[model samples]
Target chain A: MAKEKSSTKPESPAESSGHGGGGKSGGEVNVFDHLELLSAMGRDFASSLDIEASLKRAIEHITNYVNAEGGALFMLDDEGETLRCHASVGPVEIIGLTLEADQGIVGRCVQSNASEFIRDVSKDKAFHGGVDEETGFTTRSILCAPMSVKDERIGAIELINKRGGDGLFADSDLHLLEAMSASAAMAIINARMAEALVEQERLARELELAAEIQRSLLPEPGGEDYPVVGVNHPARTVSGDFYDFFPLDDGRICFNLGDVSGKGMNAALLMAKTASLYRCLGKTVRTPGRLMARVNTEICETATRGMFVTLAGGIYDPKTGIIRLANAGHEPPLFHRPDGEFQDFPAEAPPVGITPILADGDEFPEIELHLDGGTLYIFTDGVTEGYLEDGSELEVEGFKTLIRDNAAQDTATRLDAVISLIKRGDTALRDDLTLLAIDDAKGHAARQAGESPEPVSVDIEAAAVEEELLLSLTVPSRADRLKTIRNAVTEAAKLCGLGKDPAHDVVLAVDEACQNIIRHAYGGSPNGKIKLKICRTEGELIILLRDFAETIDVSKVKPRELDDVKPGGLGTHFIREVMDETYFLDPPVDGGNLLRMIKRL
Target chain B: MNHEIKEDGGAVIVALEGDVDLQSSPDARKVLLECVGRKMPVLVDLSGVGYIDSSGVASLVESLQSARKTGSNLILVAVSEGARRVLELARLDKVFTICDTVEDGIAQVRP
Candidate 1:
């Protein structure tokens, strides 16, 4: 290949028209014709957005200007392993011909990143006659040029059999073809970049839409005293984990946990449909087996691409501590009893969307469990497979240990601990972790009666949840500052619908409690801090006061007798007089004491 | 907490206002004890009090004890419903002399 030094631009087009027509063949056209052809190639390539059309016009102009009988333009496929002819002008139909990227005269042009000029194909060792043999077309001469844009090789263009005058190609032909291939290469690269940008935009919109759908599908948080708590953390844009629980008129709570087996839009849409199906059918279906069967049939009828959901649905009766549960290809739910024994209920049937019908009619196999004051945990594999703080997978054993360790916390608080355990760091979860816990409220009540540490498990578990703690304030244990607590308590009592007199009673009760914390818990040290939290759960209001002090033996702290009330000891008496229930709760954090008071609304 | 003290009809009238909690109860105790220590008839006006805790009740009880030792009549006047409830909870209602208004307390204490 010649060094590109000679100017293809003619001194004057009118003056050089004498040799303008390249039909003169191998005698070679004047610089005027080369100038016109080069400009025309640039124009044609730039004018059309359709890359194939531009390349076709470019190759035809190049072949005709060099006065060859046939020509073909080949492009490297996306993987760049093979060169396929995209446009061609020839005696034989060669538009779809394919060749290894490193074969024949054209392949050498691409590999060499330069032009090839062969006077006799049979004399050139790199020339391969496979095309001539297949098409019966004789090729005596060849001119090929590599097409490249900014160091990226597009492919090569090949011209065969010079048609005029000595029938041999010269250096001028190779130079002209090389200049025009650059324009063609530019067009192809630009088209690829534009296509990539469009695909990126399309995916971004789909992810955003899926996120909004997931947000709308999740239900309101379960109340504090309610036996259910759920937490969901997305791996990224959207995840397939979902759970929902709602109360029925008969005092039974219906709940379900599911992991849809896909990602992105498909997973998000299926989650919405399946969760709604369980919630809608769960209200009236009554039996867990029948509900799962109906939802399974519906999912199978509409779901595509072998997508499925591993689900466990149940109706919990708090009154009798009973749970009727059905598991469909989900991870086995762990039931942790108060005495520390765990029972696991694994999947009993195929996943929700895989089979349209059950072997035994339309009902799945169901198990009636007496939770008997134990807690039931249902979670997606994301939790067990998720990376923990130390970057190790939590797995099932680790998850069981986590539950046992935080077993004393309220259900919502324990679920939060599970979420943070797998959250790892500030980074989004590696996989979407969805966890739900069903703590038997009866168990909590029974444990509270026994003065056990069970009711002491504490958590503000606000894991992306609604603000359940209406008031949380930390103030110094100074006696004068108790007024602020009183005012806040009065407002909290009013917000929860306590009448004027009753509200004041609660206010004074909280005030007296703070005073006691200042006096007894802090040893009258004003430097100590007290954290007060007020929350309303179901039909009761709960006030929890936390103090960092020496732990007190709650059994020894007694309210003074009303008949024998003296000036200084009336604080505990006032707390017991107004609040329906009062207990010095066990603090989950070390060295701090927690006192809980409840007033039935 | 805010307070007003004056002599009215041969009685040391001590009126207290605002929520009398643990923080402000000392101030309340100061004003009440100063009046009861005079060994004169003391009429305690509590209508301005909105909320009172046990500490505030303790201050009042201490002042009442001082009044008894000094042989002075200590009468609680216009006790707010909330304060009355606290007093009743401590069974202090049976112990302190409570009247409907300052005039009633003054009439009862002077008669």
Candidate 2:
């Protein structure tokens, strides 16, 4: 009962004045009535923080205080171009309606930022009859006032047809409405500001989660003996640029870098898709051009609107010192010769996802370079377009100069020099940055010589054979164990009277095969073990690798098109390229795979 | 890895030091992702870094993807030797914008 009275107390002023009868009384009594009304209205305004509910209560009070037949509160939209009727009373449902800010008396009050009183609405040129047409309400006189906070006009409130016999709205009525409108305007602004802050906080949390998922898709760095590296710096939480590298069975490294157009989640998703496609297809396809074509077609089929990928990739054969490259609308890669000359291999084909299919004959064109002992630098445009503090771009020429200056340095130092030159000023990057450096085998040897010596422990077990078993050993599926495994295999091959070239090929093939088992079959699990057995027959050398890991579908294990131009799946391609014959056996009942390869001596 | 974030204009500049490897990449990832969530341009300073492994590179890549989603930019400033080598070997130097200093990174973002 107390709650009900407290709520109704604010309405007592309107009931006591007999609906606009306050104007009939003299000045002192009218002033006293208004004072009571102002206090009551202030209590109602403080009752709720919700703008719509509080505005509705305020309008109801205004209509009763002024003895109006109808009243409406309009609010300005964000653009401040139009007024929307937010709350209404005593007439048709005009709530949720819109009007031009300059349309009627309410608009006039808003424009002038002052209260208005009309003795006869029919005589006023500013009176608009659209509401009457819609609501079937006749207006005799009207009172309107602008709603503002801190001198900024937000909207206005209007009351129509004073209810007394005179049917006229007085100046006092306009003044009361003006006071209430000011308070309402401040409440509305406060509510909206609060909502915006909450929304900002929600969005920030979602983006962080998205970034975590994207991070897991990238491969680990610094495992390859090929002296390769890649960096992707996003302007946001996730990046649309990606790069990947994997060793082929033939001691070569297949690597690729790509950029998806636009930024954010969509681009990141597309980038992951494109990278995976390249990796899956690159395994089957040995030719860089053919591999890129297949990846381009796949991207075109799946990419969303306004999305595409620019890719530059290649296969670097460490033995022959040859690099086969394919570019798809990506920046030209720089080839730095040992003699200090730079060669640019620019794009010859369009970016992927732009067309349904690449041009038939010239699809991603391939470029081949024989680097004796030089270094091949493949990169995206981030390097060439890096900005300095002066706002000048590090153009291709500047990139070349940096490369030339650092050409004599080791691969790591050379790459560091180039990046440092681009990062010489205090500025943020405008795009993702990526670079790949492939040095000749001699360079690999040079880098390796600086590394600390590893402890050598050989445990070779011999199985009965006609003459002798070359070598047999078992090691854990770990990257560090690879060197010891390779050395033992080479020594065994040498004892079998194999020439240096054949011995080298045997060593490479065995190393690549073990790498595949460790990386793919064992999934890099340190606990997984691989057994290597090499035996020389009367006319052939046979090698077998056995692993206890999940079995792969041998039938599905084929290299993608050579033009796929991505990384991964190249282990099989390498195995096929280096060995005379290779076979992947079905898993044994206990769950393990055996890979066998043969080379005619 | 250790990092500090500062606001410059409408962007956030993160200064990173120490080796960013498998062991420390998670920490780097957290700081970078937080900066990206602000939906403003980000600049990572790697001058104080001595080494960065694949996981470190992956963290930065993830940040780039997040920035793109939020319509912000992520840039690298003052790349160090180890970070540069890993980035170059993976061919990411061409994909990310490298700047010489934080001021340059801020200028690029604002411009």
Best by TM-score: 2
Whose lDDT is greatest here?
Answer: 1
lDDT of 1 by residue, A469-568 (tens): 6788899999878878888998898899889989988988898888777766776789999988888777888888888888863422333322223345
What level of docking quality does candidate 1 show?
Answer: acceptable
Q: How many backbone collisions does model 2 have?
A: 81
Error of 2 at A87 (Å): 0.8
Q: Evaluate all candidate structures by whole-model CA lDDT and list the values in order.
A: 0.80, 0.74
Q: List, residue by residue over B7-104, the lDDT tens digit for candidate 2.
A: 98888888888766434566788899999998889999999986554446667888998898888889999897656755765578988999987888
RMSD of each: 23.0, 24.0
What are the per-residue Cα lDDT tens digits for candidate 2 across A11-77?
A: 5433455646754565775676666666665666555666688788778877876778889998888
Candidate 1 — which pairs collide?
A408-A457, A409-A457
For model 1, what is the alpha-carbon lDDT of residue A41? 63
Q: In model 1 chain A, which range of ten residues has the least summed lDDT?
A: A1-10
Q: For residue A500, give model 2's deviation from the true position in Å.
A: 40
